[model samples]
Structure formats: C-alpha cells, structure tokens
Target: MQAFTGSTLYAAIGGLHVGDMLVQLVFFIILLILVKKYAWGPIIGMMQKREEYVANEIEIAEQNRAEAERASKEAAEKLRQTKEDAQKIIEDAKHIGGKQEQEIIESARQEAERIKISAQEEIKTEKEKAIQALQDKVASLSVLIASKVIEKEINAEDQEKLIDEYIKEVGEER
Candidate 1:
C-alpha cells in the first residue's frame, strides 16, 4: 500500500509507451483495410456468382420437367384416340359381315326355289309325253281291231280324224 503518485504510477505501468501503441494500431487498421479491399471483396463477388448459377440451373430443370409432363399427357391422349378408332373399325366390320351373310343365305334360297320349279316343269312335260304315246298306241290298236272285224282298209287321213273325234268324246265324258 504505497502512495500512488503520478511518477510512481507511470513507473508501475512499465513507463507507458504511447508512440509504439499508436504505431501498432495504425498498422492493424491498414491490414484490415487491405484484407477488405483484396480478399473479402473477391470472396463476396464469387459467392454471388455461384448463387446466380445455381438459381439458373434450377429454373432450367423445372422447365424441363414441365415439358416432360406435357409430352406424357399428349401421348396418353393419342393412345386413347387410337383405341377408340380401332373399336369403331371392329364394330363396322362385324356389321358388314352380318349383312353379307344374310345376302348369301337369301341367294341360296332363291337358287333352291328356282331348281325346284324347273324340276316340276320337267316332270309335267315327261308325263304329258307318256300320255300322248299311250293315246297313240290305243288309237293304233283300235284301228287294227276295226280293220280285222270289218275286213276293210281305211285311209290314213280318215283313221286319224276318227281317232281325234273318239279322244274328244272320251275327254268330254270324263
């Protein structure tokens, strides 16, 4: 506990070198200014450029993704349209096939009917021919029997006329 006079306090604080302290403070401020102008300025500029690049890349990626989604939707719509077209075509084909089948059946039925009518006409013609031959044979037998019984010969024209008249009479009786 000695008395702290100005001279004794200065001696106790190791003689207080103000000039050296001021010189050291000025150098430290100069060092800080140099670091701010050279190193810190470049570092801040590089960080800003890197941020802008990253943002641009993100925007491009988002645009690409949206385009991909639009393309996928268009492809799906085209596929649906194609399927509808195919279904319509199949239905039309079936309808056409049914119509053709009906036409074929009708044609076949008409052909069969025509054949049946032709066969009936042929049978009628053959029957008429057989009946005509039978009438001729009967007329010949009648003429032969008449000639044998009368012992007279008749002319051809007279025999034919007689047979026609007899056939007419028989038809009228029936």
Candidate 2:
C-alpha cells in the first residue's frame, strides 16, 4: 500500500517537470535570434546586391535592343534615300542627253542650210558668167555678119568713106 501511494505522488509532480522544458525552449529561441543578428545580415545584403545586378543587366539588354532597332531604321532610311538620289541622277542624265541631242540636231540643220545657201550662190555666179560669155559671142557673130553684108553691098568709094569714119570714131574713143 505505501509503494502505490509513492507512485501516485510521482505522477502528480510530473506536471512540474515541464518548467525545465520551457526554460530550454526559451534558451534555444534566444540563441537563434543572436545567430540571425550576427550572421544573416551579410547574407541578405549579398542576395539584395545580386538581385540589383540582375535587374541592371535586364535594363542594359533592353537599351541595346532599342538601339539596334534605331540603327536598323536609320539604315533603311539611308537605303531609301540612296535609291531616290540614284533615280534623280538618272533622270537628270536623261534630260541632259536629250538637250545635247537637240543641240546637235539644230547644229546639223544650220550647217546644212549654210551649205545649201553657198551652193545656190555658186550656181548663180556660174550662170551669170555663162550669160556674159554668151552675150560676148553673140556680139562677135553680129559684127561678123554685118561686115559680110557691108562687103557685099557697099561700093569702093563708100567703103573708103566708112573706113575713114570708123578710124575717126576709134581714135576719139581712145
């Protein structure tokens, strides 16, 4: 009967043993807080710096993408402008060639007109000379015919008088 009462007393006192367990739990929590304060600050700072670096890299990549797009647009504009300039140059060349051709044609026409005028002048001069020669020949033939007719009709005394008058007219002309 006494052994049974001692066991019952032990069971009643078991609740008081939980006081030591609570003290142990409080000590563990204090140790955890001290370790976090000393060790965790640098780790968290390193993680924050890593995150900022990654964010900066993403920003740089985005900027590079925008720059590439701008360069591509500039290149396209340059190509288009070059093509337009080339077309304008070709048009200008064509216009200049056409103007030169027109000038050449006009020059050729003027030269031909001058040549035709020169040929006409030469022909007119030749015709005048031929007419003068024909007139001289006709005068000589008429003189010959008149001399023959005079020789057949005139008498000796009249021939002598006519000869003397011709000599007097020739001397006056000289």
Q: Per-residue alpha-carbon lDDT of model 1 for 67-157, expressed as tens digits?
A: 9999999999999999999999999999999999999999999999999999999999988987887788678767765875477566787
Q: What do the candidate models score in CA lDDT, each in turn?
A: 0.86, 0.84
**lDDT string, candidate 2, 46-145, tens digits:** 9999999999999999999999999999999999999999999999999999999999999999999999999999999999988887677657655854
Positional deviation of 135 in candidate 2, in angstroms?
2.4
TM for every model, in the order presented, reads: 0.64, 0.63
Where model 1 places Cα greater than 4 Å from the true spot, the runs are 1-29, 145-174
Q: Which model scores highest in lDDT?
A: 1
Candidate 1 displacement at residue 77 in angstroms? 0.7
Candidate 2 Cα deviation (angstroms), residue 101: 0.6
**lDDT accuracy of residue 30 in candidate 2:** 93
